[model samples]
Structures are given as C-alpha cells and as structure tokens.
Target: MKKPAKIWLWVALVLCVCTTGLNLSEGRWLSVAIAIVSIIGLCVLLFGQRKAGYIVMCVCAVGSFVVGVTQNMGELGAALAIVMSLIGSALVPVITGLFIKSQWKELK
Candidate 1:
C-alpha cells in the first residue's frame, strides 16, 4: 500500500484502540467488542487484505452506528457515536480507493 493509505490505516487503528479503551472504561462491553473488531479489521488492511479489511471495517462501522443510536445514551453521546462511525465508514472507502488507484497505476 501507499504511504498515505498506510498512515490512514494506522490512524484508524489508533482511533479504534482509543475508542475501545473509552468503551471499556464505561463498561460498554459491546462497544468494546466492536472497537476490537475494528482494530482487527484495520490490521488486516495493513497486512494487504484490502477487500476483506474494507468489508469488516464497513460492517463494524454500521454496527457501531446502530449501537450508538439505540444505546439510550443522551443526545450528545448518540451524536458523537454517529459521527465517529460515519467518519470511520467513510475512511474505509477512501483508503480502499487510494490503494486500488495505486495498484492500478503500478499495473499500468
């Protein structure tokens, strides 16, 4: 993968870890599990399994969003969850596209 994509993936991994830690502190086991899964998906991306990683990340992102929306948290918490999930979800596709473009250029 390209430098930018690698960096982005690392950032995503860090974000997942941090989110997992926060969820752990809050005793939110399900959120922690989701974050852990996301971290694993990011590791897969770093290891060059682009399609699988992207799919895992996308699924986790949606799961996170749904959990956030239904968790009975206050408005602010729900909004934050929604925003984070959206950002994570969006990043997967952008990073995947970047990797694909780089691969295409190399193939040419």
Candidate 2:
C-alpha cells in the first residue's frame, strides 16, 4: 500500500478508538463529530480502490451506528450497536488487505 494510504488508515483507526472512548465518557457530540470526520478520511483513501472504499465505508458506518445506539439510547440500540461493531471490526482487516493488494497491483 501507499505510505499515505497506510497513514490515513491508521488515522481512521485512531479516530475510531477516540470516538469509542469518548462515547464511554458520555461525550456523544464529540464522538459523533470525530466519527464523521474519520469516515470522510476513509473516503479519501477510497480513491485508491472503490471496492475497498465501499467495504470500509460500510464497516465504519455500521460501527458508528452501533456506537450511536449503545450510548444513552436503550437496550435495543445497544444490542444492535454491539452486533454491528463486532461485524465491522471483523471485516476491517479483510478490507485493509484488499486495499493493500490493490495498491500493489497498481504498483505493478
């Protein structure tokens, strides 16, 4: 993968962690803002590969939705969020691998 793409992916991950941490602290608005920005950052990285981008976007979106539901919402929301986050987290590595492979393909 390109250096910039790797960097951006890490940044997204950091932001994801930050948002989740903030959520636990009840900083809902801040968490949401960070999540939104990270999602966009992920999009910028998407230019490298549409399929990778779409996968990452879906994962991040689902993760965000789960987080939103879990906090200060209700049991239903929490359950949904938990499920989505788990699924998203599981898919993240696969999408990242695809991104790296796509980058390598371009390099050839």
Candidate 3:
C-alpha cells in the first residue's frame, strides 16, 4: 500500500477505536460490536490483506447502516443516526479503497 492508503487506513482505525470507546461508555453494545468489527477490518487492511479487509469493512458498514435504520425506524432521530453511520462508517472504507486503487494505478 502507498503512503496515502496507509494513512487512510490509520485514520479509519483511529475512528473505529474512538467510536468503539464512545459506544462502550454510553452502554451501546451493538454499536460497540460494530465498531470492533470495523477496527478488525481496518487492521486487516493495514496488515496488507487488502481484499479481505475491504470485504469485512463493507459488510460491517452495511450491517451498521441496516441496524441504524431498523432501530431508528419511523423517527427523525433514527434517520439522522442512519445518515451519520452511513457517512462515518461507510466513508472510511470508501476513502481507503480509493487510495488503494490510486496507488495500484500508480504502480502499474
């Protein structure tokens, strides 16, 4: 992975850890679990298992999004949560993926 890709992965890892901590403090078990999964996925990416990490991250992102939507269904607050999770959790892997693709192209 290129420097930029590594940086993104690091950022994602940090965000996942922070989110997990926050969820734990607030007693949100499900959210914490999702963050933990995301952290593991980010670690896998950092360790050079790019495809596996990407898959893991994608699954976690979608899982979180679904949970957020279902849990908050029929409420404006829930809608907000869904949007935030989509942006926060989903954006990380996407940005990392973009950097990875750019690095691969550069290599070629």
Candidate 4:
C-alpha cells in the first residue's frame, strides 16, 4: 500500500478501537465483535493476508453503515446529519479497503 492508504488504514484502526469501546460501554456484543474483526483485519492486511483484509474492511464499512443508520433512524429531523455522519464514518474503512484492493498485485 501507498503512504495515504497506510495512513487511512491506521485511521480505520483507530475507529475500530473507538467502535469497540463505544459498543462495549453500551453492552453491544455484536458490534464489539465487528470492531474486533476490523482490528485483526488491519493487522492481517499489513501482514499479507490481502484477500481476508479486503473482506474484513468491506464488512466493517457495511456493518458501521447499517448500525449507524438503524440507530439514527429515529431522528427524523436530523436525516441530513445522519446520512453525512454515516458516510463520513463509513468512508474511512471503505476508502482504505478500495485502495488496498486496487493494489492487490503490489501487496503480496
């Protein structure tokens, strides 16, 4: 991966940790597991598990998008904020995953 991709992956890692902490505090075991997968995914991605890394990153992005929308759906008046936030949160992992996926030939 290139420098920017690496940086984004690091950001994704931070987000994964935060996700774990937030879900743990809220007693959401499934989200916590998703976050754990993201953490491990990043590690494996860096260590040459490119295919698994892609799968994990994609899963994390989708998971965050689904969870965030479901949680924020009740805020009818804040629909714009909800969409923006969801996109923003999901982009880190999604973008990072796309970048890594594009570099499949270079990674291993």
Best by lDDT: 3
**lDDT for each candidate structure:** 0.69, 0.56, 0.75, 0.71
Superposition TM-score, candidate 4 onto the true structure: 0.70
Clashing pairs in 2: 66-81
Q: Estimate each model's TM-score.
A: 0.72, 0.36, 0.81, 0.70
* Candidate maximizing TM-score: 3
When summed lDDT is taken over every stretch of 10 residues in candidate 3, the lowest stretch is: 99-108
**CA error at residue 39 for candidate 1, angstroms:** 1.0
TM-score of 1: 0.72
lDDT of 1 by residue, 3-102 (tens): 7767777776776687788889999898789878877877876776456766677788788777766674465576675676566446655565566565
What range of 10 consecutive residues in model 2 has the weakest lDDT sum?
47-56
Angstrom error of the Cα, residue 73, model 3: value is 4.0
> On a 0 to 100 scale, what is the lDDT of residue 41 in model 2?
43
- Rank by TM-score, descending? 3, 1, 4, 2
lDDT of 4 by residue, 21-56 (tens): 988999877667767877787877866647677677
Off by over 4 Å in 4: 75-85
lDDT of 4: 0.71
* lDDT of predicted model 1: 0.69
* Candidate 3 residue spans exceeding 4 A from truth: 74-79, 103-108
